[model samples]
Structure formats: structure tokens, C-alpha cells
Target: MEPEMLQRKIIHVDMDAFYASVEQMDNPLLKGKPIAVGGSEARGVVSAASYEARKFGVRSAMSGYMARKLCPELIFVRPRFDRYKEISNKIRKIFHEYTDLVEPLSLDEAYLDVTENKKGNPSATLIAQEIRKRIFEEVGLTASAGISVNKFVAKIASDYNKPNGQKTVNPDEVEAFMEGLDVKKFYGVGKVTAERMYQLGIFTGADLKSKSIEYLEQHFGNSGRSFYNLSRGISYSKVKPNRTLKSVGAERTFNVNLSSEIFMEERLENIAKELERRLQKSKIAGKTVTLKIKYSDFTLQTRSKTLPYFIADKSLIFEAAKELLYQEKMKESVRLLGISLHNLNTEMKKSVVVQLKFDF
Candidate 1:
């Protein structure tokens, strides 16, 4: 391990069941009850479930019907993204008070590097506790925190004692701690990857560490290097304060499936407008336009076109999306329509800047 890697201090902060908790906090009647925030049981997925619902095996991304089956008394509420965003902004303000090296993974989770924080706090653990304390005191919500030398270990530690808890992994204990961890618990190791690892006789971090980098690369491709380094408690990725935007997109699921091409065009227009709005707000443009369609049967199809130049205008985006929509034949009545812009100009500019530095 590099000496510089050990010198860094990182903390991962995650809100505890953010959406469901917000619902409960706003309405006292929901306290101590199992609740899910999402669409109705008929044609919706669970966006978030309270810890009480999780005990009954309900989880985010699960079908609402299945969630209800798991926990019969589960209450459902529509998502209030606007409210969530408002609260997220407040939390971000709190994070900025401690360190500008804060990288937001989502509205409810972020990674902060406090090696040289504004407060000059030497103890990352104390900083994490303080941050969590302020979040609860000011936001009326609980947060879990993980403190460690690097982001990967810190992120995993955050989940160890969740829901208003904090965990810290000292630098000396990182190796032993990682070796004892289950392969499924490793960051980036999803269910499918874990199953594959199990078939390969790699069930834990220790088992993963036993495999050669070449062997892992042969089996997992580019992700093999990440698995190799992460299992050994090595991650050099920094806490990027202004992470580059990769893509801009917007989608909407309709109450009823629309079979008519005209109605689909109207939906596409609205989705394109939303995508353009997001791109403009971010001050970014992209060359690729993708059209996503989800059928009533849950099947999804996408068509994309890469333009000659980057564009953020609504009309241009809609024109490209409209062309992609017409390029493909509809298989079923569509329940959802979406538009996305990719290959962002910001990234292109970054590449240009890097090349210029190399030339200089």
C-alpha cells in the first residue's frame, strides 16, 4: 500500500431510509409503521421502504405487489421528489461547512474527504459524529456514517451499524476487516457477480484476495482490477467535489399504456423538454440522444442516435429523439417514455484540457 493512501481520511454519510423516514417525520401517524414510498400496488415499484418494512423482506426496487405480499400492512405513499431535493440541498449545505471535498453519490448519500478540513479536525471519526449530529438536529432525520482511510472501506463501514449509527475502521485493522467480509458485501459485487464468484469458489474477501489479478481480469474483464484492489483495501479514487456529469435524462411512466404513435410523440416531446431543461441547468450538452420505451408487459427497448455536434436545445434534442422513435417499430403499447443525452461536452473539454497540458 502507498504511504499517501494511508494518509487520506474519508467518510461516507448515508441517510437512513431517507424517503420513508421523511414521510414518517412529516406525519407522526406513520411512525413505527411499515411504509413504502412509490406508486400504487397495481402498476408500481417500491422506491424506498422503511426499516419496519425491510424486516418483512420489502426493499427498494421491489414490485409494490410483492412488497405488500411480504408485509401486508405496508402503507404506500407517492414519491415527493421536490421535497426530497429541498432536504438534500439542506444536507449538502451542512457537508460544505466541514469540507469542500464532498462527493454526492445521490440525494441521500455522499463521501467526504476531511484530511485537511475547514475546521482543522484531526479526528475523522469525531467529524463524522458531528456531521451526523447536525443532520439529525437540523433536518429532523437520522444518518449513518463510516470513517476510514479510503472511500471504499468507509462506504462499507457506513452500512455496518446503520440507521443513526457510526462505524470507524482504523488503518491497522483494514486488511483483517476486509478479509472477514462476505463477498456479497463488497462494493460493486452485486447478486449476479456474487453468484459467479461463488461458482468460482470465492465466497469472501480472503478468497478474492487469493486469486491472481490476471485470473480475475480473465474472468471479470476491466472490473477485475477494481475487485483486486478493493479486496486488498486499496482505492486511490479521490472525493471529487465537482464530479463530471456523464448523462442527462428524464422519463415518465403513464397511468395507461398508449398505443397511438401520436400520443407517443407527445410524450417524447415532454421527456425531451425535461432532458433539455436538466442539461441547461447543468450547463452541459451532449452528442448522443437515446429514446427509451417501456411496454405494459415490463419489456424495455431503446433506440439512440449520435449527432455530429453537442446539443442542449429542446428542439434539437426532440428532433433527434423523434428520429430514433420512428427508426424502430413498436412491439407493444408503451407504459413509459424517456429521453437521455450522453457523451457530454464537459467530458470532451476535460479531455482537451488534459491533452493541452501534455503537449505543453
Candidate 2:
């Protein structure tokens, strides 16, 4: 491979236990506690479990019943998919501040190409560390970052030092680093694939690299080409910029304070209905809801929440929205109300682990 072609630097940033961690950040009481967000009761499932809860082996997608059984002291908070979306948007705004070449994998994970960033900074490692520090200071959140010459190495680097940590892999160290990784940790090898590889005695990169292309293909089929290239730690995929603005919402103001419940209900209903239509036509279903409001005195406040998954139902949208409006206590008689959904990119539903390998 030409050295110039591999000179680009990529960084992967992933928030720590995104949903649960946000809840812990907003409310000090929940800090440092074993917390899970989703269903609180025995029948509920854990959407996101905090680092504390993870110590007990609790994990996202595990049933709530099993989580509590694993750790009796675990605390369950109802999942706020709406709020998580808002925070994700805030972080996205921050990302754009640095570079437009940001590809968000999910609400909490993204690939940032800073090889020729807007800042003109020479060190990708410094950019990653700065990004991590900024997230903590600005958003009251912790993020783990990985820095490498390309996306595959960067993504793996991010996981190496996780939960508010960061790692960087220099160009010369790529071979040594990937050669030492377990086969299971290879980009596309999940539980089933790893078990099959284990049965084949392919425990590490060295073992995977030992097999010939034809032999590996005979065993693993077409994926053998992927295994061959990934064992050498090579990736060529480019960062996809998240530039689409899926939905837009606007609110107006009136000089007189709106004290009539009937008028306010009618007003909220109109805005909510319009927002709902925009989302539907755009094919954007969001778990996050943001309510924009202005006080009688022209002051403003906004509240947002994220849901378990994407939802396009008008009633459900307004229901969560009305709840947020009321929760804000309507301190000043509301002159205007607006609601917007920002988690439009959640539509990228497929597992983003596209092997990150060139099937040579």
C-alpha cells in the first residue's frame, strides 16, 4: 500500500452508557450509583446500564428482571429516549464546530475524520483528547475516543480505554496492535462468528492470518476475504458526513400572555400537529422531543426527551410533548409553543459494523 494513501487520521468517539449516564448527569442524586434506564419493573428490559451497574454484569438489552437479580442495589429509571436525542443533537452541534466530516453511528457513537480538519491542527490525537475534554466540560458527559490512521483502528482504539478514556495508535504500531487482538474483537466477528472461529482454532489475528484465502473461504465462505484483510489492520472506507437536516420547526410569539387553558391547548395542538406532519412526510421517527416555549415577558425555555425507539405516531408525540410542557411548570403565561424532533438519523438501523475491511 502507498504510504500517502494511508496517511489520513480518523477518530471514533463513543459516549459512555449514553442514556443512563445522561440521567445521572442531570440529577446529582443518581451519580455513581448502579443505574439502568428503561423498564423499572421486573418485566422491563435495560436500555442502557451505567458503568456502576455494568460492574454487576448488567448490560443493555438484558431483561430488567435479570439486571436486578444480578445486582440487588441496582436502580432502574424509566428510559427517556427523547432526552437522549436532545443531548445527542447538542453533541452533534459540538462536532460540527470542529469538522463537518462526522459520521454518527448511533446517538452515542460517531466517526470523525480529522486528517484535514477545519482547525488546521496537525495532531489527530490532540484533537481527540480536546474533543473528549470539551464534551465533559460543555455537556456534562464523558466520552471515550480512539485515534488511528483509519476508521477500523480508531474504532478499536476507542474501546481499548473505555468509559471516559482515550487511546491512539501510531502508524508504525498498527501491525503489532492488530496482530495481538483476539479474533472475537475483529470488526465483524460477533458471538456466533467468534464461536465458529474458536471451533476452527482461530483464536487471534496470527491464527486468522495463518490460513490461506482459499482454505479460509472453504471454511468461512465469502467472509474469508474480509478476515484476511482485517487481520492486517487495513481500512479504506471514508467518513460519511451527517449533513441532512430532516425536520424543521418554528414558533411565534404574542405580546399578551396566554392564560386560557383552552387557547393554549389549541395552540399546542396546532404546532404539534404541524411538527408531526413534517416528521411523517420526512420518514423521520424520533424518540427525542423538544418543546420550545416563550414566556409572556418574551423569555424562553426548552425541554426535550428521547424515547426507546423511533415513533411517528402523532398522539404519542404530543403526549410526551404535553408532558414536557407541563413538567416545565408554565411559570410565565406561555405566549408561544413549538416542538421539534432531532433524532432523524436514527434511521440508519442496520448494524454499522460493516467489517471495515477491504476484501482483497
Q: Pick the candidate with the highest lDDT.
A: 1
Clashes by residue pair, model 2: 80-306, 81-306, 81-307, 82-288, 82-305, 82-306, 82-307, 83-305, 83-306, 287-307
**Whole-model lDDT values for every prediction:** 0.88, 0.80
Give me the runs in candidate 1 sitting further than 4 Å from their true place.
4-6, 347-360
lDDT tens digits by residue: candidate 2, 1-360:
675455567889999889989999988999999999977544466889999999999999897778999989999898776789899999888878787778898899999877676787778888888888888899999999998877898899999888889998888788788889999998889999999999989999989888898988898899888898888777777787744565456454444568765577667777778777777776667667888887767587989988888776778877877788677456778767788886765444222322222111
In model 1, state the lDDT of residue 99: 85
Give lDDT tens digits, candidate 1, residues 1-360. Answer: 545434478899999999999999999999999999999987789999999999999999998889999999999999999899999999999999998888899999999988777997778899999999999999999999998878999999999999899899888778888999999998789999999999999999999999999999999999999999888888877788877878889998887889988888888888888888888888999999988889878898988899899899999998888888888678999988899998988852211110000000
Per-model root-mean-square deviation over C-alphas? 5.0, 13.5
Best by TM-score: 1
- Cα lDDT of candidate 1 equals 0.88
